[model samples]
Target: MIEAQGLTKKYGDRTAVDGISFTVHPGRVTGFLGPNGAGKSTTMRMLLGLDRPTAGSVMVNGRSYADFPAPLREVGALLEARALHPGRSARDHLRWMAASNGIPVRRVDEVLDLVGLPDVAGQRVGGFSLGMGQRLGIAVALLGDPPVVVLDEPVNGLDPEGIRWVRTLTRTLAAEGRTVFLSSHLMSEMALTADHLVVIGRGRVLADCSMPDFIAEHAASYVRLRSPQQAEVAALLRRNGLEVTDVDGELHIQGRDAASVGELVGRQGLLLHELTLVRSSLEDAFMTLTAASVEYSARQQTPAGALR
Candidate 1:
């Protein structure tokens, strides 16, 4: 498990990270989310002991990251995949990392195979593609067989197959009782992968909760219906004290789920063509919750001859 209490960071007059506290438990994947310049990078740096916090502390298990004799064995991290010696072979890089922490030399090949880099293990990292570089970095992280893994944008630059591999790998790690802390900008992928969430805005922890709770609390849900008798259906629903919005030819309703709405319409003998429940996606909910916290906003202009 990882815990941060009143974690803070500062740069001259700028406060990059405010006092933030949260816990990342084991046996599940906890996703870190924030918009650009929300201080996510700084917070992660503090967690890994790459930067000193102006106040408070962040600890893996029960000790600071720097306190471990073999830090990689305690906390395997992939903060910056490209921060490596470009001229070194992938196998050489892993070998050096293994040697630094007294890890067995054979572990290098194990991690190389685990990250699907054994075929290109002898290739220089400078010539590796972005995706291959990411894989090599993952191999370095797993070389020590750490109990806790922290990955930021692990799927960045990965193709569909590579992305799926990462998803499965993270799940497998967590299932083995390791604490997995992941950060990614892809909301769709995060929704599918994360069991819990730790959302930040302006350096403060905005939310730390389960996936279902976060979505249910921040997202909107409504019943959508299309009927041959549109006018009667709208009137009936309105008279029944439900909020209804008509767009084009469809009626969007609140205050009831699809089944309840369907039952109500059926009891009134209304002929319905379509009825379904529409819930806002995780992206939608994130946008709604972090609207004000977004570090940048742009004014959109319609192009000439654009469709309405």
Candidate 2:
């Protein structure tokens, strides 16, 4: 398990990571989510002992990363996919990594096969495509078979098949009781891959909760009602003090659940064709929560100053 308590980082005058605390427990995939420039990379660096935290502490398994005699055996991290020698073959790269970490050379071939890179193991990494490079990076991370895994944007250059493979692999690792901490900007993939989430915004902990709880708390849930008596139903709903919106002849009722809406419509004797509850998606919740935390936002301008 990974535990971070009051972790903070500073770069000269700027504070990149504020005092934040979150726990990544074993047997599940915990997604690390934030917009660009939200101090995610900085926190990861501190966790790996690559950067010193200005305050607080982080531990992989009851110990700091530097305290481990064999760090690779404790935690495997993939912060950069291209942080390898371009002239080296995929097999040679893993071989060197294993040698540095005192891992067996045979483990190199095992990781190659595990990442579906055995076919390209002998080829120079410079000749590999983006997806191939990502796979090689994952192979290095898995060389030690550590109980903890931390990956950042593992599917950045992957195709659909590669993405699916990564999703399954992370889930399998978590099922094996390993602590899997992943950071990604892909909300759709996170929704499928992560059981819990730790959302940070502007270097502060915005939320830390289970996936379902996060969505329920941040995203709006509404009941969509479609009726042959659309006008009557809408009027009745409005008269009842419920917030209703008409879109394409369907009445969308907010601030109430599907059961309440159905009961209200039934009491009015309105003929209903469809009544469904639509929960806001992860992306919707993310946007709503991080709107103020976004560092950069593009604003629309009047074209050529023609409008007053």
Q: Model 1 misses residue 215 by how many Å?
A: 0.4
- What C-alpha lDDT does candidate 1 achieve relative to the native structure? 0.93
TM-score of candidate 2 versus the correct structure, residues matched by position: 0.93
**lDDT, candidate 2, residue 190?**
97
Largest TM-score belongs to which candidate? 1
**Residues 2-61, model 2: lDDT tens digits:** 999999998889989999999999999999999999999999999999999999999988
Q: Residue 224's C-alpha lDDT in candidate 2?
A: 92
lDDT of 1 by residue, 1-308 (tens): 99999999999988889999999999999999999988899998999999999999999999999999998899999989999899999989898999899999999999988888889999989999999988988887788899999999999999999999999999999999999999999999999999999999988888999988899999988889999999999999999999999988899999999999999999999999999999888898889889999988887887877855
Q: How far off is residue 271 in model 2, in Å?
A: 3.7
Candidate 2: give its CA RMSD in angstroms: 2.3
Model-by-model lDDT, in order?
0.93, 0.93
Model 2 bad stretches (over 4 Å): 266-269, 300-308
